[model samples]
Target: MSEILFITREPFAIQGNSRPALHIMPDAVYALVVTDPSLDFEENRAEPGYGTLLYKAPASSDSSDEETTGQTTLHRFAFTRKDLRSTCTEAPVVLKLLEIAKKLKAHVLSDYGALYFRDENGLVNVTEDAQAKSYIMGDKGTRYALTPDGALADPASLPAYLAENDFSFLPETQAEPRAEQPQHSEKPEKPQANSHAPAAPDYCKGMGTLKCSLFSRAYQKNVQLSINAYYAWCLSFLSGINCGYQDFPEQMLRYPIYPSTSNEDIAFLNAYCTRNPDDPFISACLALRTMRLERQ
Candidate 1:
């Protein structure tokens, strides 16, 4: 499904570079923005009123936490430091958000925040290379990342990348019927003691591209294979397929695991591989076997 990736610093954490690393998909169907309580408010403030409503709370609630503090007309809620987490209405909420931000003249962005949305062509980022920390707002249900530069460069050439990576798109529609093999037109079969067997299907190529990208960037260096690596792999793999299923990789646990870490895991992975040897993640990883990066 479509998702939004919210890139933000770990509010109060004191370790590692405060760069974007977490991936947050929108958990609900609405979009909203919560204003800093310090900002002055007026009920009739927004011109032509973009259906903007003022959220009220007891002064005591503000000191408690975000959950206890506000009441919106809608229920499902999520938040970020910039308070872009609010109720989404019938209209495209981001446009309304831009309107509200302009009206409030609030210091609208974090030092470095960006909004990344998926389009037919692939994913695109609204903000590029934000200098410091910043904030982004949208109701696009897209994925996000907190990068210093706010860019996730596309693979060098997507088709070539996909092909070279050995990923294949599933047939979008029903298949045409095949003519039957000619009956009783048998030529003498060649008899050999050891004719070469068909090559094993390559399943690791694209998955390996993910591993290489992570390793080159030190995201997976010296780490045991974990779900986070798998999650990143799923994200990278989904970026290439044109299967027409918008919610590809809906959950990481559903992604295939080939080249399993143990015999038991291998048993399961092999079963999946047997059924889907040309699976996108596996095929791509096998095709792009030479994924080692050369650095200066």
Candidate 2:
């Protein structure tokens, strides 16, 4: 599993190149970051930002703790120290960090406090304090708090009322299942061999490009798409295929195309985008159809 160890220190605590002392665990496999006053910086800064992401050297009997701490600097952001706080969470760096976290399946942690994990929706902040209100970022960038009863407490009332509720009543959160495959008749009619390919549905016409990036991100993380997007895409792809099958039952049957409810199509698109980020999202969907045909 991927992990990241985040260490935060008091602002300006490191004087004259002195670094924080890190206790390296022998089995630790995580990306390391050390920052002043921690990564959970307060909003706003008067100057530019700066920081470093370190890759720990493999643990060895011959290596001292200091030698194993930061063997290679994977990334560094440099600016005026005063601005480092603001820059650390800038869009570009945040995206990069999220991408890294997703790849590593990293659970974001602060040395001082809080734990975070990335899911299909986005980052979820789960605190150790049961009474503390946990927050999650929505796909549309809205912030919602999880109440003790597991309801999404009103965002407007979050600050004022969330803390007042005792969290001992909080129930264990269960993982939602991925997309459910649509039920189909056990025996499907075969489409005619000479039938033309199905036309794209109206709803799907311009959706691929619009939804591609979001789908790509979730695909890379091997998670399901957001609820609305998943259902919409399913409706489009499956409806079109069903229409074609009804129109030409015989031909379509020879090359059966089973709709993937487990995100096989997303994986295909992810690979497609990795090869060419600029490729139209619809092109990958079309290619997936062809692949299914060949496999059949």
Tens-digit per-residue lDDT, 1-296, candidate 2: 22223322121122232211111110011111211111221111332112233223233333111123344312332212211111233233344444444332232343344543344666543455644424433211234455544444474653333332211111112122546534664774564221122334456555565434556666566665453364366447655775778865532424333564334444455544443344445544554544433223
The lDDT of each candidate is 0.29, 0.35
Judged by lDDT against the true structure, how good is candidate 1? 0.29
TM-scores for every candidate against the unseen true structure: 0.17, 0.26
Output the worst ten-in-a-row residue range by lDDT, candidate 2: 22-31
Candidate 2 Cα RMSD after full superposition onto the native fold (Å): 20.8
Q: What is the C-alpha RMSD of each candidate to the true structure, in Å?
A: 20.9, 20.8
Q: Please, what are the lDDT tens digits per residue for candidate 1 over residues 1-296?
A: 22332222221122342222221211110111212232222222222111223333322212111234344222122333223333332223333333443332221222233433323554332444343233322222122222334332232332332332121111221132557545577995653211111232455353443322333233224344543454456445544442444574332123243443222232222222222233333432322211110000
Off by over 4 Å in 2: 1-206, 221-223, 227-235, 250-261
Segments in model 1 whose C-alpha atoms lie over 4 Å from true places: 5-82, 86-91, 103-113, 116-125, 131-296
